[model samples]
Target: MQSTQLSPRYRGLRLTALAAVASMLAACGSGGDDNGNGGKPNTKPAYIGAVTISSYDGATDDLLTAGLGKDGLASSTAPLPLNPAAPTAAELRRYAIYTNYRAIVDTSAGGGYGSLYGPNVDAQGNITASEGKVAGVEYVAYSDDGSGQQNVTMLVQIPTTFNTTQPCLITATSSGSRGVYGAIGTGEWGLKRGCAVAYTDKGTGAAPHDLDTDTVALIDGTRTTRAAAGKNAHFAAPAGATSLAEFTAANPHRLAFKHAHSQRNPEKDWGKFTLQAVEFALWAINDRFGAVSANGTRQRTLDQDKVLVIASSVSNGGGAAVAAAEQDAGGLIDGVAVAEPNLNMPPNTGIVVRRGAAQVAASGLTLYDYTTTANLLQHCAGRATALTQAPFYTNPTMAPFFAARCQTLAEKGLVTGANTDQQSASALQALRAAGWEAESDDLHPSLAAFDVAAAISVTYANAYARASVTDRLCGYSFAATLTDLKPAAIAPAPLASMYATGNGIPPQAPVQLINDRDPQHGPYLNLPSVSASTQRADINYDGASCLRNLLTGSDAAALALQAGQGLTLRNGNLRGKPALIVHGRSDALLPVNHTSRPYLGLNRQQEGVTSKLSYVEVENAQHFDAFIGVVPGYSNRYVPLHVYLNRALDAVYDNLTAGRALPPSQVVRTTPRGGTFNTPAPALLPSNVPPFAATPAPGNAITVTANTVQVPD
Candidate 1:
């Protein structure tokens, strides 16, 4: 570990600068006013709204585990609200932490929860009996303009153990369209390391607008009517072409998610929101720990120059970290460490990605491009005879729909085959040709079975297109469904608790993805809804095709979506910050071929030798560690990717704080915890997931020369 003390020379200079600023403020009559009558006007960023501050004791109400502690977090069942219909903000915060923590981590002890990485596991990788709670002060606010449309949630958690002398900050942007607590598991690393962790939803969260009741979620996860919530509402459906009442009456029981219906193309601002969160964190730290003059004015105790800030997270949040690094004009970020980031590489980068001896057929595609393609073909691909042995392949309920999807693809000439098996094989081949690696094949069945592709495609299409909920883009709407699969009123309990439980994307329990264009069933759950043209329950193939068309089509809406995608592209520059990205080669959701691999290549191209980015490709690891414990086959085949993320963060922190060298870009061939498919695998051992080698063997090294990235088999 590095010493948390500044060099004497640097400290002297910083103090001199602070004294000069203090003198100037005093001369201007703004030096000593704690009541906001003066004193430099509360240096809070203009973008940040009113802040809510709360304190917690490590034992009962704490920051990291939300008082659940390590044991409670690892438990299968999460604590629920006493009053489900109206959960208090405190209860919702606890529930959000529990759900979001478990959502990304493999909590089972057999999966390495206790031994490898959990609250009980200390920063040094030693197992301890402690519950791992940290006393802290939390600051929450909305990063929004006056309209309140872009109420991106910002939160800062400063632990009592935080080292103010050698201050460190980590950004934990919310992952997977989840709420503010979405990356709580990732934030644990920084919290345990005595760093203040800054979090932001990046303008996308679990806040849903119940259009029927005109109710919206607030920043604290409490519900109120849109009219009453006013500017504090997390999200409310904007006035569309038709009045709110008329639209609600026409499309009753529908819900509008902030990510999909905010009409802000929030993904474009993810990097900005992440930076804003850091800004908020700085402000909070200064306000809490700054020096107080005799006149009671708070003076700056920490600034960007004095703090070691690392932009870090996983999945979408990881992408945001990278973006923040690229857009960091103020030199706020010192380093970056992320895992399986969903990065969007700019088109026509002239960067080539090669794995083993073969050049990849496709690289650097946008999220919607591949996600929409997966949505269209994955179900059909799941029917391939080769994938029959894949995990979650024996689904009696969805097997018929998979077959129907194959038939539909064959009829549309999207796939060529005389039989369902052949067409399914062709669809699977299409995915591989379009950038998905062969390692992703086994996970397709499970992802498609869980409606992962469809849910993401629908949500992202609307988000990128900036479509209003009233548009029902691609014939899809979010709503509660009856047992009969018909659209129904969203239950009060689910709606109220959605901020804690619902991922922004629909098909989240009661909030199902509704296919409004289902001619036969008339607004039903997308899984069983019939396509009008084919009159078959082909898992809403028509809607999937429409979303895919948005990527390839030249129509007005498609053009709008394409334009929105343009706004989310990363420039591939980390501004010379030392960064490490670890990605699972088997990640089905955000394939490395389109994400980390290409981004690495692009970064090298953009920065040349000045780039300090290292990419670690981990084999036998897939996205979604949460699936490892409960999802039968996952336990046997995949090690927790979360462990690698922690290792990456540790390496980056050491590099930034102690001037250590980062591990060379390499492929880490992880061994899976192989065992029976349905039973829990043997306990995860350190040998299964090795630490990064200081000098990787030639075969494992990932090399980048000029604009090309080459990975060994």
Candidate 2:
């Protein structure tokens, strides 16, 4: 769980956001004039400016250029002589937000967060977002919140066709910048698909979308075109939702949220600002995208087409609350899905925080608070020990919708009472205070014992062991004799744990070259100067980012597809759509254990709603690499990314005219790992060759695991 950032879903937003212009129409503006009954209703929603606007679809090139020039005050026609610095109605209409980055190295002899690989990240490029043909610009925007905070940013091409009836998703700055990451938006999956995208600075990259990426001067009157932030008043959490922390900063409207990662964290003064964006989105969509009123007190009603809610979860706390509010609003969201949301976990490891509806909520536990498992361990332990329980809002369940999948996780070995990192963090303290720990079988588990989330966060170069255990592979071992042991033929094998092996789904290929231990590549980066913590920041830390949003398989994906205007078919049996679950077998961070059940449960929850759910095990893949390398469909470019692109686009076009829901029944297949060893590999003695010789191979394998990492730590 190394706080996986919300990338795939962030990409999911691009598809959904295609309809931003149509969906964000200001339903009806209140004239504030007394109607037949004191407070009267007006004609259409009151127009905001002197000239009425049908929508912000970049109708004129002048408007686009205005926001970029004229000393930040590029005044435009209508709308109060627009200040280009502010997010334009069109820019906002076509905006896409997420964590995206290109690797950048601190070349000053010896400095921060070492290099990506042996070569400095800068040497690689100023940007590495993804390899698609789409153009992108990066920047850093400074907000005069009067807080002395300077914001860095990155903007990318978030193209949208006019009047296309589609759903759109949004994310806060989970990564520092360059999209959601840094350098450039090269690591993204959507840009490859040409989705119009936008982002804040995840790192020191150029600002493509920002009106003021290169200079101190912002778009003049930029503040004017922007929506003023809500006051920093204290607000209570809703009934079912949890109240995580409080802050003094006003909520970050969509524009402000674009700069969320610009300032460093661990300080309230360093508040996250996107929560407001979430609330505004809820209000905007319900009011126009679907058929709902803008007033917070009105009933929610969506179009027959389902709408999806997606977030990065990195700076997702505020966004989570907004999503919850929208889902609860009744009809706005047919399905609510977040990538990795932790609405109220003790994030920041140990940073004690106040509850602020205005401040953005980061996704994971921090150095100040507990880690993922530890936070959950506290929750579970709290349930077991407390005589009087707090209400859901008060005791406040974080990620309850998703956490409910815990039972499924327990069925697999993904979740264990004792080994959870959080449980381990509190081990000794619990023992000393409560007489004994909570697990039915204590094992007097180490308070800091290796928990799946914590372990995976630090590095994929881990050895899964139970103390003194010398070797561990997902679920395979090297053959005593290498019959197919040729160097060119080596491949990864599927895992075979009892539950994972037997669970119904797609059958997976067995690893060709079974190894005696886990892959190790940390040292290969050639920077003894870097540590796991540093690695976590540059490439790991997803705890806070992904927590902003997540929705598990089937139902979640279905919701996303609907929002994006994709298709689904109902299988005959009437069971939930069966999914061919796929994950990296040797994955160290979000270990296969934690992933299995939630995946299986998704299939179950959609039972009677879908049909024929299944699972597949990718032998040696990591997280994000699935689509990048191979594994078409699930992670492959063939299935969903490219092969399915035109089909998905067609689906969007069809939905705009007719009210046709997606096909409920479907079949999905996850690709096998890149290599396919015919049999197995011969054991190699610590040869006379350099130890580093075999190391790069493991590093190559590490990319798959980087799929959902959180923003720059």
Candidate 3:
């Protein structure tokens, strides 16, 4: 998660870096009332003046499109007037509470994270670094909060050459502070093919230490520690509803949970923050085009219409891309490329997350609803032990049982031989103590032993594994040779014990006692009041209600947004634009179904234009693996998923501009290492399988006219 900075690949283009020009200060005034509540404006509105290009060497306008000459390129509009009524820039700026603008040139040594890759890759997948320029333009904007000013900086990169014969594409990377730089570096590959890239800070990417606090301020206006954070906050059990206490009472063997990750923003402002970043880039395109056109650097202008918003995420940011597009409704977005996107669906809406109102009433683990067997399974060995320890696994009964089971497994030789029982117990005790001792102690070190012990215990505890004696747990068993259970055609198949354990909730776990719960956690959850097989499934609306009570004075809109209904900057709906979605079948953060569910929902509602959307489930892929490279030095079992994703993006561009028929929805098959994909691949598993079958079938490719789903085997 590197900061969004332009790679040194732009060294060649810096000679033309814009020079500093005398900036004219516009008188400050409250732009307008943007609260939408129809109330008087609370704070002074932000003022935005005409963007001034401080320096322009104009060494070569080859990067400029030929339609508009580079000379005299200036903003089509004048500096927004100081009057309170001027709302264009003011309205946009309100989304981000920045109040100041400064003009300056930031030159990097042309080195950073981008240097790790062999060479810059072009959009066409060619390895080259010839025509790109990375330059920083200090964009200073003051916050009306009186916190002074914040630098809403942007890194602008352009290929020194352009396919001037056609409109040049401008790609904006708004992947946030840590991710923006990496995305820019990746997007710079497009520079070889005459694309311009802009990276803008959404003012939301705060340092880790500040992330929670900053996010709280940005969205909720401030952060508050709930007094009842660790206390049971659920209400009295509702009649006919299965409460947590009831479930536990019925199954005393269930684990008692200690709730955590409780910090939540009652204000759903991250969506607006992301949208603001996109808007800033749009503004920059106009500003740069105007600067180049005014300076007469080239005879053409960059294609504004051809601009596209590209975002790839395995976390909240993943949802942001779709949210932004849906909110903008193709107004600012033409197409979207999302990989394992974590769309902002409200809690308790899906099978994996729902809890009865009364069930929720009896627990402090509202956020803990996100943890499931499938998700925790992704945390292997050392990582896996974290699931059993304190905050995450505070299940009082289960924790000791899991720990004892791990000890028994070590004694029985059913566990990995990497550690003895004494060693594993020693490590486990240390981990548990750390949970009770310090919050910041890195628990990852003790996890491997913990997971090893837990794996053995969990396996032995599960009735399904009663007949097995196992070797070391492996994570790659999903792609393993069925005959020998060895890594199939891939080097260094990491142990697949995790995959072998299966994704079912283990026996003795409280999840097993629940009849209506999906072992795969997500926004979807069946109300305990209803049977799991009942078609009357609904999200736990009470999750939002509970959160509202926790954050007294919080606007209900935030909860609604989280619940997947309130209006926000991003609507999550695609407006009949060419779109490509890729999700890893094994994504731990956001399951593969997240992608399919949204596609089907839109197909049902949009009533047509199914051809506009293409979804691919990459076999054996994980949530982040498709976009972010494999974790550090680990040998990846799956192909470089991004290679396929970039190709999909290329197809999206063609569908948008050339009227080419988009590819059908299909599964992206993986070949052995070093294999190349000449065509879109099919799935290793059919849709009739458990996860897919659990939901309505979405057939192979979506039918455009009928808006019907087709899931081809």
Candidate 4:
């Protein structure tokens, strides 16, 4: 559905980014140090030119490959080419460029550099400068809205100096704005002769913050000269709001409030103009790139080749829209890598893949919300940091705030609240029985909705709440409406397909990455947890900026991958780049014993041409302490970018983007086994890889070529 709702910030941001070109960007990270000046640029002469499919006939391509599955794609990279398409600067500028990586925590510099300089790391192990491009770094943001997201493409460029192209290798990154396919593959340290590289989110924040340089000026500009924009930047604060979510969370206040004097009068904020723009960046090579053959080479949409997609569990939020847009998108997609997918269809309901709350309120879904709720009554009732006195999740002083939210939603029929229960003793008792503990669990859409619904209902029914029964249910201050998870069957189409999400990643997925070690959080390591698995912080880190954030935020694992410790497909054909690591057997997160297919579809489209892959997981490392947390002493096997960059680029060149095979990352006893989380032991590796060679790539691109072996039919 088209939304008339618009966030004026969007307009302000675009104009701001455009204006920023002339202005200096704000310095960030480690007092603004390490902007790629230290590393020597790889000046080696090599093949560099691009070749793209431009476009392909979907009827001819998709129809033929849709049913071919994985086997067909694995073997097609036998011959390939090397060329670099010179996309105009204007064309490239439209992409959301990762301007810079900075750090934002602790004793200074930025986290991006902490591994080499600060208190963030003690060992500063020889991860290698190449592997650690920008770890613990915060990304500088720049948005480009023109990248045609509906189409999959493989752009390859070879160095002009090197004309002869035989087995070349390449690697690439996928822009989150689009989708990720053929993520970086393994097999480097020399393999695949013609390898290339590509790199995304490079920043840390909610919904790719300051996406445009203009946003800074747009916002800062509005602060100074709104008259120039002619009030186009004149947006209102939430009517009766006293503070921004940021402000409210910082300063204590009562959680409950009536919607008074809305800034837009009756209109609501519809979120960032994501519907208009999305960003993504990646490198593709090898068979993943256009295939290099004796007769030259060819490129195709990623879907035309055999590839697998790294599920955007943190970003796509179960891409209900992807499904809705599928037919309309035609050949745009093939297989799907949906991590912790919401599979909302009624058909997907009964099995209970994973269940969380729906339609959470602003007061309970974000640290901002819960913190606001915690503070809402504090100052009003004369208390400071009241919730801090107890486990914030179980604070007693904040009960009234929770009561407020519950009552408000109940009268509106959005939920069953204090008055709920025609049958179950008193509604208040029912809430208590439902696990009301005064503290907020807004960490996820699952728990947050239930918490906020209760809070809002309580606040509205208060003798003084400035609300009405007739207020529109469409208010955007928070997630008001949500899917009912009771015994009721999920509705098909619209209901199950509704474009909305609530809390965090389904569950086990988070723990899979965290991999705890203790039973005191007991059964740590391999299992998922409430804190580490949060979706709000992963995909959306707009709340704060800290290099430590990259490690703790949602998608923490995706952002902090150590070599040998990542999610991997059981089959050898797949690639994992910008790799998001997960442990296998994560019942609380992704479905067990199954390989997702988002990338495979892209591969089919590209006719088995892609140079990268993104997700890698260990076998059976579910919420048991085999992934993340405080375990110490042992070096995290999760390959830091420094160590990974060298080998990854090599793999991308020969194996990933190029469609060859390179050496796999070495799996070692890396993760710790105590403290908080334990790392999964020796990451899983594919057994069916073809006979491969460590062929180098043309120039500086990554490369890989797997050992030749028969792919299963």
Cand. 2 Cα-lDDT: 0.23
Against the true structure, whose TM-score is highest?
1
* Global Cα RMSD, each model: 3.7, 22.7, 20.0, 22.0
- Regions of model 4 farther than 4 Å from truth: 1-131, 134-338, 346-713
lDDT of each: 0.87, 0.23, 0.31, 0.21
lDDT of 4 at 425: 21
Best-to-worst order by TM-score is 1, 3, 2, 4
| Least accurate 10 contiguous residues by lDDT in model 2 | 247-256
Scanning candidate 4 in windows of ten residues, the lowest lDDT window is 98-107
**Model 1: per-residue lDDT, tens digit, 554-593?**
9878998999999999999898888999999999999998
Considering every candidate listed, which one attains the maximal lDDT? 1
Q: For each predicted model, how many residue pairs clash, with residues at least 3 apart or on different chains?
A: 0, 142, 69, 258
lDDT of candidate 4 at residue 665, scale 0 to 100: 17
TM-score of each: 0.95, 0.30, 0.45, 0.29
lDDT of 2 by residue, 1-713 (tens): 01112223223445564345434643442212112222212221121111111322222322111122111111122222133234443342222111111111111111111212111123222323321122322212222233333222222223232122433423333322122232122222222232222232322121211111111212211121111211110011111111111111111000011111122221121112232223333333333333223442222232213333322222222123222332333322222212212222221222211111221132222211223333223223323222122112123323231222223233333344443333323432442232121211121111112122222211111110111111111211211122332112111111111011111111111212122111233111110111132231111112211221111124442233223211111111212211122333323223332332122332233343232322222332333321222111212111111112112222222232233333221112223322222221222111211111112332222111111211100
Candidates 3 and 4 compared: the better one by TM-score is: 3
Residue 429 in model 1: lDDT: 99
Q: How much is the lDDT of residue 125 in candidate 3?
A: 46
